[model samples]
Target: MNITKLIMVLICSAVLAGCASSNSGAVYKRGEARQVQTVKMGTVESVRTVKLEGTKSPVGTVGGAAVGGIAGSTIGGGRGSAIATVIGAIVGGIAGSAVEEGVTRSDGLEITIKLDSGGMIAVVQEADVQFKPGDRVRLLESGGTTRVTL
Candidate 1:
């Protein structure tokens, strides 16, 4: 493979990555105004790790395929080169999709809270904040999702 083409392919992959994102990592979306949420005081009972689903977008696969095809076409002449391009596209697409998933996947938490009012509830959200048992925390509820913040 041509070194220059390979470098170009890697650059394309990096550029395309910004086109795909998952709602898994951040506590809130940037630049979007949020409404006031219902706040409930509670004590952390337990905190456990959870996996946030990764984004599934065509950006990575398409970008990788394009890059790979271009790189592979440089490999030989005529029919053999065409075959290599096709094979390279297929393999690159799959690899790119896996890489995207790995990059977007996030660590989450399953927090069990004991509400001061005498009830137990669990909230699962991105583990952006640290929580420990016996910690005083606030449960913020809005938009059908709940989050625990210090």
Candidate 2:
């Protein structure tokens, strides 16, 4: 591929990577700051490794399609090139979505915690921290979001 197309692919990959947002328990969104959170004490009942799915965004699909179309246009002359471009774009779009998802997928943890209030709940977050059974943790809940932290 030409330098321009290569640059475009690199940019698309960068954008897809940037689209991945943190789901770690230690990370908080700007809106979550200064807001009151209901703190609950709990003990970890179990910890399991999990896979976090990646994002499917138009940026990947469109970027791939554009690159594919350009690459395909260099095929046979006239109508044949047009058809190739269309086919290439469709195939590239599907491949791009899959690539985006795979690239953004991350490891996460499913933590089952037993609250001090006699309730059992399981929380999943990015596995940036380790947890084990019987470990004391805090469950911070606000705006329907709950995070397990030590």
Choose the strongest candidate by TM-score: 2
Clashes of each: 0, 0
lDDT of 2: 0.90
TM-score for all predictions? 0.82, 0.95
| Tens-place lDDT digits, model 1, residues 1-150 | 577676867786676567655443244665335677788999999999999877768877877777777767877889999999998888878877777777778888898999999999998877777789999998877778677788
> Ten-residue segment with the worst summed lDDT in candidate 2?
66-75
What does each candidate score in C-alpha RMSD? 2.6, 1.1
Cα RMSD for candidate 1? 2.6
Model 1's alpha-carbon lDDT is: 0.78
**Alpha carbon lDDT at 29, candidate 2:** 90
Over 4 Å off in model 1, which ranges? 1-7, 16-26, 30-34
lDDT of 2 by residue, 1-150 (tens): 588778878888888888888899989999889999999999999999999998888977887888788778778989999999998888888888888888889999999999999999999999999999999999999999999999
